[model samples]
Target: MGIMGCCSDFLQRVKPYVAMISLQFGYAGMNIISKVSLNHGMSHYVLVVYRHAFATLSIAPFALILERKVRPKITFSIFVQIFVLGLLGPVIDQNFYYAGLKFTSPTFSCAMSNILPAMTFVMAVLCRMEKVDLKKIRCQAKVVGTVVTVAGAMLMTLYKGPIMEMVWTKHVHPHRSSAPETTDSSDKDWLKGSMFLIVATLAWAALFVLQAVTLKQYSAQLSLTTLICFMGTLQAIAVTLVMEHKPSAWSIGWDMNLLAAAYAGIVTSSIAYYVQGLVIQSRGPVFASAFSPLMMIIVAIMGSFILAENIYLGGVLGAVLIVVGLYSVLWGKYKEHKENKKSKVMSLPLTLKNSEGNGEGMDIKDEDEKGKKANSMNLSTSDDRSTIKVRFPIPEIPMKVEAPNA
Candidate 1:
């Protein structure tokens, strides 16, 4: 709470762009750390349950202390919305993402996540929550960015080419006739993992669209995050109980298991969720969305350095495309921000000039005092110039679309 308070105060004094970069790195750290935990053999189901548990516990205190009075009363409709959010986000998203990692590799899963922003954009557009101006550069950039990101996701998932063996020459000796290649591509789990991760990315993207709409009706981001975590805790616990009740899956007496669970619960769930909420509050959801691809880069680098994971050509090309697409969207956003600033600067003079002429006293001769009395009598004169208006930056809450019940 103290850290968050400091962050909020710092953000108030600083620019939003600096806050955005900090958020991107924080999210990237979660991915890299989660990958480390997954490699330690934690069950995805357990991880999901523990994550929600930790998150609920961490946030519930704040909800009680800070938002007790103003918090919206839980109603049947809100319950339904909470249920949907729990199912889609922490339950489905976390489960599938971790399961995908189990079948494939963390690098693969992280790479696939880069497509989320593009998917969200499409979902938002389809729901009429976002408008597109094909002629405008900003809209054009967004459209192109979305297409590029999708293409990158495809490249990452579908194309697994021959390893560029040279990349690992310094790290390991090349296998010759004396030694067979260690990797076994015939494993069915790899393909299954690849497919599952793609599905996970799509599910997460859908969840983002729903959450965006929900945020509109519910202005309290922190409160909404807490509710979702609490609901997800219940949902995950139920599913885990049903699925892992068998005697074989019930064993939990191992250091690795406990460590993995703790990592997922404390670091990934509690800390990451708080950071994400701050990001969404400080920057708009779209800006946060565009940072996903950059997180993949961090994942790839960390995986290579820490776990000695092999990098593939397809992964490289896919990462490049994702970066290109992400930057395109970011560039467009930067341009829009600059344009708004320029527009406001231009409008400032007009507003001041209008104020000076209409509100402030205009220079008049004493001889015209007689005429001034007559002119003042007609207060609502024929002079229409008094009502000059100037445009400013667009306010937040662009449109009315509830975050998805999912």
Candidate 2:
């Protein structure tokens, strides 16, 4: 039982780490698969609509079943929050991210997304959800880590060095037939895609922050996820109707498009949202976003395998920096959490002592009052003896007679 308890405790501690890491793999797969679907000429707007629709369908049943009892009643404010969440995530983030993926390689898109942690940290700080005390070493670590992570992401974006070949990718070569077309249109398209990715990332960061706030009210993770997906489905449909007029774009017939929508909906939207909400609830948005760099790494490797994408030395270097910064932030968070627990534990004795001291002081005050009353009574009795002596003056008598002698 003791060993089992220890293992359980350990698992609870590591669960967030494991969950976020696993989420990165899911996100990596989504990026690659979604990129493929986009390359196959699926409309990004329509894809967003289908993705959230599928997400709503896949997760609604579980949410209804699992959260039927615990789900909080949605008030008007909560409904508004859910609406904004849908706008940020499914409509803005998904559409922009898909459009970005269309113009850029999955690896570059993932690399660009490494900026999420920094953005989230800043927003969290601004929203007062995260604390920042420059005097504290842990706070300093987090600040520095966020800066370094952003710097690394920028370095990856601004600089591309010689291509780096992996052991498994030595013989893998990009097809030459598409090279001329890519070279012709790569510069402007890549710039546009980077802009889209940045916007998407900003929206994604806002979504995290808002989701954290929403959870405070709603509390039910599955229910909130389903609501977000459902709302997003509605919002995305409106956007898709305006942006994609061709009905043919919406037609799905068992291809990568269908696979992309279904997989992203079930895995990334439904499961990912629920898990991320759990993590964000347990830790803050910063910790939840901290694992994004891992997704970049995973996508880098996977993109190389699936897309035969070239890996650059600058990207490699930037990834190392990002990982270092990620660990720094995590260490700071751990230390801060540990210090908080310690402070709470240490404060317990002081609080008890304070209460005890107050009780003792009251007792002492009562005893002091009783002592003063006793002293006053003694003085009064002395005064009464003096008054009797003064009023009926009894003199000292000389006793002369000895009866035994007589």
Candidate 3:
């Protein structure tokens, strides 16, 4: 039982870590597959529409069933928040991200997205959701990590060093050469893609902050996910109509396009949102966003294997820096969490002691009242006996004297 209990506790502790890691893998696949679909001529606007549409369809049933009893009443304010969420996520984030990915390689886009944690951290602090005290080591670590992460992102964006070759590149080279050649993008395109990615990351950070706030009111992860997807689908459709009018652009056959939409919608949209919401609820938005670097790593490897994308030395160095910064932030967060938990645990005994002292004081007062009542009763009995002796003493003496005289 002891070992089993320990295992259970360990699993509970690692659940979030496991979930976030798996989510990164899912996101990596989405990036790779989406890039392939885009390369095959799918419009980003149409992709966003179909992605959220599929997400809504996939998640709505589960949300309806699972949250039937627990779902909160939706107010007008909540509706507005949901609308904003839809705009931020499905509209702004998705479209900009897809555009960025289309302009840049998946690996480059993923590297750019490594700044998400830093962005989220700053936003969280601005929103007063996260507290920072530079005096504390943990806060220092977090601040330093954020700076380092941004620097790394900038390094990746501004510099592209010599391409790094892998062991499998020799074998993979022939296959890529045999495939249709892709036009090389210029430095201007790189900058444009970076800008788009930065905007997308900013929007994503905002979405996290808002989603965290929304969860406080809604408190239903699955339901909230479904609503966001549904609303995002509608908004994306509107955006798509305005941005892309050609009916043929919207057409998706049974190809990479359909797979991208379905996979992204179900996995990254519906499931990711729900899981990330749960994590955010438990560990705040910063913690939820901290795993973005991991996704970058995964995407880098996957993009190389699947897309035959070149790995640059600058990206490698920048990834290292980003990873360092990510760990620093995570360490700070872990230390902060540990301190908070310890403080709460330490305060528990004091709280119990205070309550117990109040209870003891009440008990002492009751005891004192009982003692006074007993003393009063004893005094009253003694007084009654004394009064009886005084009232009956003369008659007893006179009867004794008359008997002696007879």
Candidate 4:
């Protein structure tokens, strides 16, 4: 029983990080598929509409089953907040992001999105979702990590550098067009696409902070994700109707478009949102966003291998920096969490409960008596809410006797 309890506790402690890794893999897969679909003449607006519509359907049953009675009432304010979340996340963020992907490569899109952790950190601090204590080493590490992540992302974008080795290049892909449809500039529209990506990153960061605040009230991850998807579908549909008036543009004739929509809706949107929401609720917006760089790394490798994309020297260097930043930020979070845990344990009062249902308070003082060091304090509360405080006796340090010189 003790062993099982310890195992359960350890898994629970690491669950958020596990979910984050899974979430990044899903996002990386979506990016690769969505890029292919966009290249096949699927409009970004139409794609978002279909993706969210499918996501809403996929998530609805789980939400209903999991949080049927436990879900909180959707107040008018909360409804509005969810609507705004839908706008920022699925509507504006996804739309602009896909459009950027069409202009750029999946690798570049993920690289640009690396700016999210830094943006989320700033927004989290501003929104009070996360604390910033510059005096502490943990806080300083986080700040430095965020800076390094952003710098690495920019470096990847500005300089492609030289070509690195790739295993995929050795294998000949027959019937596959060796020449890619995209280029560095010109028809690719890098500047316009990059601007859209920047806006999308900002929107995503804002959405993270807002979602964290909303979860405090809503408390149901599945329900909140469902509502956001439903609202996003409506918002995306309206935009699609205006920007993509052609009926032919919305039509999917059983190709990469359908596959992309299905994969994104089920794996990326529905499942990813639920897991990401849980992470944000358990940790914070910054912590959840901190894992985004992993997607960049995954996409860089996948894009190069699958899509015959170029792997530049800048990407290698930038990936290394981003990885370092990721670890640094995680270390800081771990340190801060450790400090908080120690403080919490120390702050706890030693309570003793008696047979009667009466409450009693006791103080635990760290007093030095006869040079003895205090070790531990045990608090036992009686069944009747009686508080009995027991002071832990300090352990006496044994003095070492001087050895006779022989």
Off by over 4 Å in 1: 1-40, 165-188, 248-250, 283-291, 333-406
- Over 4 Å off, model 4: 1-23, 172-184, 275-294, 350-406
As a whole number from 0 to 100, the lDDT of residue 282 in candidate 4 is 82
Worst 10 residues of 1 by lDDT: 373-382
Residue pairs clashing in model 1 are 84-406, 210-403, 210-404, 213-402, 213-403, 214-402, 214-403
Model 2: how large is the Cα RMSD against the reference? 11.2
Write model 2 residue lDDT over 78-123, tens digit each, in one string. 9999999999999999999899889878988887777776788889
Better of 3 and 4 by lDDT: 3
Could you tell me every candidate's TM-score relative to the true structure? 0.74, 0.78, 0.79, 0.77
- Compose the digit string of candidate 3's lDDT tens values, residues 1-406: 9999999999999999999999999999999999999999999999999998999999999989988999999999999999999999999999999999998798888887877878888999998999999999999999999999888888887887877877777676755545453345666787788889999999999998998899899998889988988898899988888888798998888999999999999999888877987897787756776787778878877787788888878888887888788778878888898999899988763111113432221111211222332111121123322211111112223444445565
lDDT, each prediction:
0.69, 0.81, 0.83, 0.81
lDDT of 2 at 191: 72
Query: Which candidate leads in TM-score?
Result: 3
- Report how far off residue 276 is in candidate 1 (Å): 3.7
Task: Tell me how far the alpha carbon of residue 162 in candidate 2 is from the true structure, in angstroms, after superposition.
Answer: 2.9
| Candidate 1: tens digits of C-alpha lDDT, residues 287-401 | 6666666567666666666665666788788878987887776677666667778999887633233235334432212222233332232222223334322323233566787
Better of 1 and 2 by lDDT: 2
What C-alpha lDDT does candidate 2 achieve relative to the native structure?
0.81
Candidate 4 on 1-406: residue-level lDDT in tens?
A: 9999999999999998888998899999999999999988899998898898899999999999989989999999899999999999999999999988888789888877776767787788887878998999999998998889777766766666656656665563433445455465733486667778889989999998898789899988888999999999999998889898788998986899999998999998888766776787789755886687788878977887788776668867876776677667777887887898899999976533333333233443333212334465555444443433454445569999998999
